[model samples]
Target: MAVAWYRARLVESRPQTPTARTLVLRAPGWPGHLPGQHVDVRLTADDGYQAVRSYSLAAPTDGDRIELGVQSVPDGEVSPYLAEDLPAGAEVEVRGPLGNWFVWRPGGTDPVLLVAGGAGIVPLTAMVRARGEAGSPAPFHLLYSVRGPDSLWYRDHLAEDTPGLDVRIVYTRTAPPGTSRPPGRVTAADIPGVPAGRVYVCGPTDFVEAVDDLLIDLGRDPATIRTERFG
Candidate 1:
C-alpha cells in the first residue's frame, strides 16, 4: 500500500511515566491503521532543517486517534522534540500505518505471548487492547522490562485495567527500597504458564536478542517467535 501523510492535530499529551509520555493525535481524514503498525513523524524547523522518527501506534486499531508512547533518550533529538517541545493542538506531519505481515488482529485463536523491553511495549499494548475489546478466546501474556517504575510506560494502565491479561513487570535497576516485584531483567522463569503459540518480541537490538536466546533455551519453538528491534 502507498504511504499517505496526514496533517494531524495533537489532541492529548500526558506523561505515562517519569521518562515517557503518551501523545494522542487526531487526524479526521487520515485512514485508519492496523495493530502492530507504526508511523513516521517528521519535525521541521524555521531554518528548513528537519528530522524524522518512526514510532509504533499505541492505540487499538479501532480507535479514532493515534497514540504514541515516547520515551526520552539521554540526548535523543526527535524524542526530546516530541516529549518537551510539542504541545496539544500542534499540527504535525505523519505518514503511517505501515508494515508487512506483522499485524495482530482481533479474533485470532492462538494464545499470544508478548515480550517487551522498555518502550518496546507500545505496539503490543495495542494488541492487548484489541483482544480485550473483542473478547477473543486466546490468552494474552506480557513480560515487560524496564529500569524501574519511573521508566515503566503505561504502568498505571497495566495495574488498574489489565485484569484479563497476564502481565509480569521486571525492573533491572535500583528498585525502590521495599518493592516486591522481580528486580532484574526478564528471564525464562518470568513467563506465565501457557501452551506454546505465538510470541512477539520488541526492544533494543541487544535486549531482543537476549530474550530470543532465552526463549530458545526454554524449548520454545523458534519458528513461532517473531521479533522487531529498535535502536
Candidate 2:
C-alpha cells in the first residue's frame, strides 16, 4: 500500500492525445508494478510550492521502466507541467506502483471485459499489454467511450490488431462521416456478450457508476465487477 518516494527520471515523453502524454520513467531499482497499478508524482516549484498527483501505469509489467499517462486538467496544478513543461531528463518524485484491488494478472482463460472512458484507458491498457506479453489466449474486450476522435488516447496503438483482443469505441459527441448512431452515452447495447467472469470499469466517477448500473441491468452480478474511478 505504501512505498518510499524515489526520484524517477523522465526518459521519454510521448503524446497519446492532444491533451495527454505518456511519460516513460525509470528508477534505479524499480520494483516493478502490476497491471492497473499507479504511482504518485510530485512536482516542486521554484517558489517552494509543491503539487502531487497520482498517475496510472500505462505499460506492461515486464520492464524496469514504466509509462505514466497524464491528461492535463483545465486549470490544474500538476498535469500541465507533466504534459508540456517537464523536460525529458527532469527528475520527479514518485511513490508506489500502488493499488491492489484493480489489478489484472497473467493467468486464466476467462474472458476479460474492460470498459473505459477518456483517460481511463490507461490502466486497462496496462492489462492488455500484460496479457500480450504473457501470450495468453484469453479473450480481452475493450469498450471505450470518448467525446470525439480528438479525445481518444493511444490512437495508433488502439488501431493495431492485437491477437485475442477486440476493441469497440463509442463516440458521445461526434463521429466520422456516415455514422448511423447518434452521439449519445454508452448503453448496454454498446457492449455485447458479457464476459464469463469479472469485468473492469474505469473512468470518471459518473461514467463508472452509470456503466456499473448498466452492467447490472444486463444481468451481470455486481459482485463480479471491479471498478476504479477518477474525477
TM accuracy, model 2: 0.96
lDDT of 1 by residue, 50-71 (tens): 8889998887754458998888
| Candidate 2 lDDT tens digits, 1-231 | 458887889999999888899999887778888999999999888999988999999988645687999999989888998998999899998988799999998897888999999999999999988898899988998999999888999877689899888998899999867778788899989986955777999999999999999999899988889999999
List the candidates' TM-scores in order.
0.92, 0.96
How well does candidate 1 match the true structure, expressed as C-alpha RMSD?
Answer: 1.8
For each of the candidates, the C-alpha root-mean-square deviation to the true structure, in angstroms, is 1.8, 1.3
Q: Residue 48: error of model 2 in Å?
A: 3.5
- Name the weakest run of 10 consecutive residues (lDDT summed) in model 1: 155-164
Instruction: Please give the lDDT score for candidate 1.
Output: 0.83
Candidate 1 has a TM-score of 0.92
